[model samples]
Target: MTRDLLGRHRAVLPEWLALYYENPLEITHGEGRHVWDAAGNKYLDFFGGILTTMTAHALPEVAKAVSEQAGRIIHSSTLYLNRPMVELAERIAHVSGIPDARVFFTTSGTEANDTALLLATAYRRSNTILAMRNSYHGRSFSSVGITGNSGWSPTSLSPLQTLYVHGGVRTRGPYAHLDDRDFVAACVDDLRDLLGHTRAPAALIAEPIQGVGGFTFPPDGLYAAFREVLRERDVLWIADEVQTGWGRTGEHFWGWQAHAHNGPPDIVTFAKGIGNGMSVGGVVARAEIMNCLDANSISTFGGTQITMAAALANLNHALEHDLQGNARRVGGLLLERLRAVAAQVPHVREVRGRGLMLGIELTRPGTDEAAPEAAATVLEEARAGGLLIGKGGGHNTSALRVAPPMSLTVAEAEEGAAILERALRSI
Candidate 1:
């Protein structure tokens, strides 16, 4: 059955669409932190559907809410006043940390980011955009234009003029040798110099933690320093929190809070975990920037009652259970365990990230060269050991991205870590 499906999938899907493992397995269903494959094999899930399964899989609260809402009204054009939408908006606005904020929902992170770009360009009256080096926003035409990762970006023809800036990966870049403070200062100086040569840009969009660029991040307070410069030139700061929001980073509810010494950004975009597998993405902005468009715009399927109900339930569950606290505690222990494993392995170059969003960067035995083959072997071996993980990195997909659900238990973390240790050792 799986073989037949695989053949059909290959025939129908685009060749560029990537699949995992030596033999791609079909996931049938899921519970809290585990899933069953078509062959009736159960695996402990660590990546959680690219971290979209925020709380848990098949959560009763979210399932019940979806069922109840769909019975009444699933969707209506954005013409009438949506009570559920308004209620979710109120809830998000209160927690978004942007003063006098307005929320606009979209179907995915790509659309949310596209909406943000539209607003920022119109308000600043410029088409030029400054994006961090090795950052990825989304896959839409507008989003692709601003993406700096050459591996993900396919074309150079775009509507906006994009300038890639320095500072997303602190350990792999030109200024890796400097201390944290000096690194931040050098990046700021680089930003200042770039701004002088280029025309005024509409905004500087960045991911608080670069997701597809191997879960890399800049030094803390780097953005606050850059914000000081952007503010003087009227350039908006847009934080793309698609993967880092909703307390995935442990210490803060939002990734931008790491740089909140300056203030909240002019715009913030989020998705993935907000709906717990349901499609929910949106942008939050100050009233001034959100209301910049002269003409009216609305998403026909955005903020529908069904998705709002799912998101509301998921948000409540996350907050009520203090899943963020779990992420901090369990994730800390998991990180320490993985670091110990890496110390014993010579190919593991660095283990980085906070909270549940951790990554293992594999390299050659004694050199800095990326060991993509090693990563591939580890992934396959992990699957064989009844564990599921993910891969990412600008360097030939050489990093193992481990982002389990926020509700992960310490026992499960230990199990996943042991499986990963054996997988790495196998390679």
Candidate 2:
């Protein structure tokens, strides 16, 4: 039956399509932090659907709200106001503490980022955008253009080189020495020079923690320095919190809160965990910048009835359960356990990240060189051992991205870590 199902999907889907369904396992249902495959095999999910399923898969409350909202109204054009939409926006604003900030919602993280870029450009009336190297904002044209990785740049590249400047450390090529402080200073100086040579940028966008870029946390005081530079140049700071937001960092409710002493960003974008698996993404900006947007610029499907309901329910659950506090406690335990495992495993190079958004970097036997093949083997082996994980970053895919549901318990986390340890030893 599983084979037949897989065969049908393969036959109907385009051959050119990238297949995440290859070598497939049919997961019939999920609840809490575990999923059951077609044969009734249970697997512990640690990836959290690439950090999207915050509350957990098939959360009863979220499922109930979604079903109820769908029964009444699934979607309506933004021309009319809806109670769910209004309430959800208000909830987000209240949690974020950005009073009177306008909300423009979208179905995906990429769309929210695209909308943010448009608003920034329009408000500042500038063509150029400054972005940090190794940042993963989104996959749209403008967002991709601002992405600092050439691997993401396709055959049809944007003709706006002057409009995009890559700042921060160059992680690839012979020019990779940009990791040094002097090199970072030089990059900043070059950006200032570019501002003088070209024009002041509309915005300087970056992820508080570079998620896809190997989960690399910038050097201490880097965010403050960057914020100061943007302020001096009259450029907006855009914190792309698509993956890092919603208490995953443990330090605060949002990733930007980790850098709050530097002043808040002009605009903030969120998506992944906003609805705890439901499709929802949005932008929250300062009142002045938000007022620059015209109503016509909004999305027709933004903040639809069903999405709003799900978002509100998810937000309420997070606050009521104090999931952030759980994240801090459980995440600390996971990190400590993983670090201990790293000490025992010769292949494990580093374990980095805060809260539950962690990464375990695999390396060659005796060097800092990335061992992607070994990492891939570990992931597959772990899956076969009844644990699910995800991959991210490293030129060759050496990092295992561990972003479990914030509600994961210490015992469950320990089980996942033990599976990982067994996989590593087997490899």
Candidate 1 on 10-32: residue-level lDDT in tens? Answer: 99999988899889989999999
lDDT of each: 0.93, 0.79
TM-score leader: 1
Candidate 2 residues lying further than 4 Å off, grouped into runs, are 14-22, 159-197
Query: Model 1, clash count?
Result: 0
Candidate 2 lDDT, tens digit per residue, 1-427? 8889878977999764443323677788899999898999999998877789998889888999999999998987688878999898887777775656767788888888887888898899886788776677778887888776555544346423324444332343333465557545665565667677767788888887777776766544455566777788788888899988889877678877766776677888999998888889999887788878666654678899998899889888988998888999999999999999889889887788888888888889798798988888888888889998877673566888888899999899999999998988876
Could you give me the TM-score of model 2 versus the true structure?
0.91
